[model samples]
Target: MRLDKFLKVSRLIKRRTLAKEVCDQGRVSVNGKPAKAGTNVAVGDEISIRFGQKTVTARVEAIRESVKKEDAGQMFTIVKEEPTVEEEQASSNL
Candidate 1:
């Protein structure tokens, strides 16, 4: 499955176009390597996405054309989520 499609269908990014834009800007990576919107994804592939102040890493569990909202979370397993250096520092000082 395409990275952008998978991101949208899994509700990771909410929209396919946004996923493509994020990928194009190099905010998305697969298996530790930067990935493009058209990148192919398979089960077990680890995907990491940068979202402003935080980064979310998830492992692909399944690839489907479509899934219900309630089933979306089953598509990937969140490995970890951490704030960016700046965010972490700011929070630490609070």
Candidate 2:
């Protein structure tokens, strides 16, 4: 499966074009290495996406040409989510 397609089908980015844009800008990584929009993705591959000051990492759980909304979450497992240091510090101080 292509990285961009997987991101959209899994509801990670909402749209394939957005996924492709992000990937092209080097904001997406697979298995710790930067990946392109058309990079091949398979089950168990770690995908990390940067969204501004936050980074979300997930493991590919399954791949399908299409998925229902309810089943989209089943496509990947969130391994970790790191927020900006400012956000973390603010939360801790609250």
Candidate 3:
């Protein structure tokens, strides 16, 4: 599945267009390499997305064309969630 589609169907970004925009801006990476909206994703691929001061990493567990809201969480497993270095520094200073 496409990266943008997967992000939407998995409820990672909430919307496909936003996911694409994020990806296009180089905020999304797959397997440690920068990825685009049309990038192909497969099971077990690690995806990291930067959202402002926080970064979220998830491993693709399953891929489907569509899923119920209740089942969306089953598609990916969050492996790591951490704030960026700048965020950590700001928090430490506060």
Candidate 4:
């Protein structure tokens, strides 16, 4: 499935257009490389999204067109976040 569609179907970004916009601006990556809206996404792929104040990483567990809200938690698993530049360096210097 397309990355944009997967983000929406998985309830990651909420809207497809927003996903496309964020992707076009290079705020999204798949498997550690930058990805575009049309990028193909499959199971087990890692997806990272950057928002203004936060970054979210999730590993794709399954792809589905529609899923119940109660079952949305089964779609993907959240991974450890990348520490901000300052925090990372600070920790390393500790």
Candidate 5:
């Protein structure tokens, strides 16, 4: 699935246009490489997303065209989330 579409279908970004903008700005990476909105993604790929003061890192466990809100979290496994600048800076200083 395309990165933007997957992000939307999986309920990560909440909107398709925002996903594209995020990807375009190079704030989204797939498996450690920068990815664009049209980048292809598959099961097991790691995704790192930067939105505002939060950074969410997850692994795509499964992909679906549509999923209920209750099942949204199941589509990907959140491995890490450094949601604050202070925490990120602290970690970076390690």
Candidate 6:
């Protein structure tokens, strides 16, 4: 599956255009290498995405043309999630 499509289908970015933009800006990587919006992805591939101060890493579990919202999360397994600096600061105040 294309990286952008996979991102959309997996509900990672919510929109295809945004996922492309993110990829064009070099904010996403596949298997530790920079990937383009049209990059090919396969099962078990590691995808790392940067969202401002936070970084999320997920392993591709399944690829489907269409999936229900309830099953979206099942398409990939989150390997790691690095909290944003602001979130960490807020938590420390508690």
Model 5: lDDT of residue 63: 89
Ranking by lDDT: 1, 3, 6, 2, 5, 4
TM-score top scorer: 3
Q: What local lDDT score does residue 37 receive in model 3, on the 0 to 100 scale?
A: 99
Off by over 4 Å in 6: 83-94
Task: Flag regions of model 1 displaced more than 4 Å.
Answer: 89-94
List model 2 lDDT by residue over 1-94, tens digit each.
Answer: 9999999999999999999999999999999999999999999999999897799999999999988999999999999999966678888998
Q: Give the better candidate number (1 or 4) by lDDT.
A: 1
Residues 1-94 of candidate 3 have per-residue lDDT tens digits of 9999999999999999999999999999999999999999999999999999899999999999999999999999999999987899999998
- Candidate 4, lDDT over the whole model: 0.89
Model 1 lDDT, residue 10, Cα: 98
lDDT of 2 at 25: 97
lDDT of each: 0.98, 0.95, 0.97, 0.89, 0.93, 0.96
lDDT of 6 by residue, 37-57 (tens): 999999999999989779999
> Which ten-residue region of model 2 has the weakest summed lDDT?
83-92
Off by over 4 Å in 4: 82-94
lDDT of 5 by residue, 9-87 (tens): 9999999999999999999999999999999999999999987788889999998988998998999999998766766
Candidate 4, residue 87: how far the Cα is off, in Å: 8.3
Considering only N, C-alpha and C atoms within 3 Å, which residue pairs clash in candidate 2? none
Give the C-alpha lDDT of model 1. 0.98
TM-scores of the candidates are 0.92, 0.88, 0.94, 0.85, 0.86, 0.87
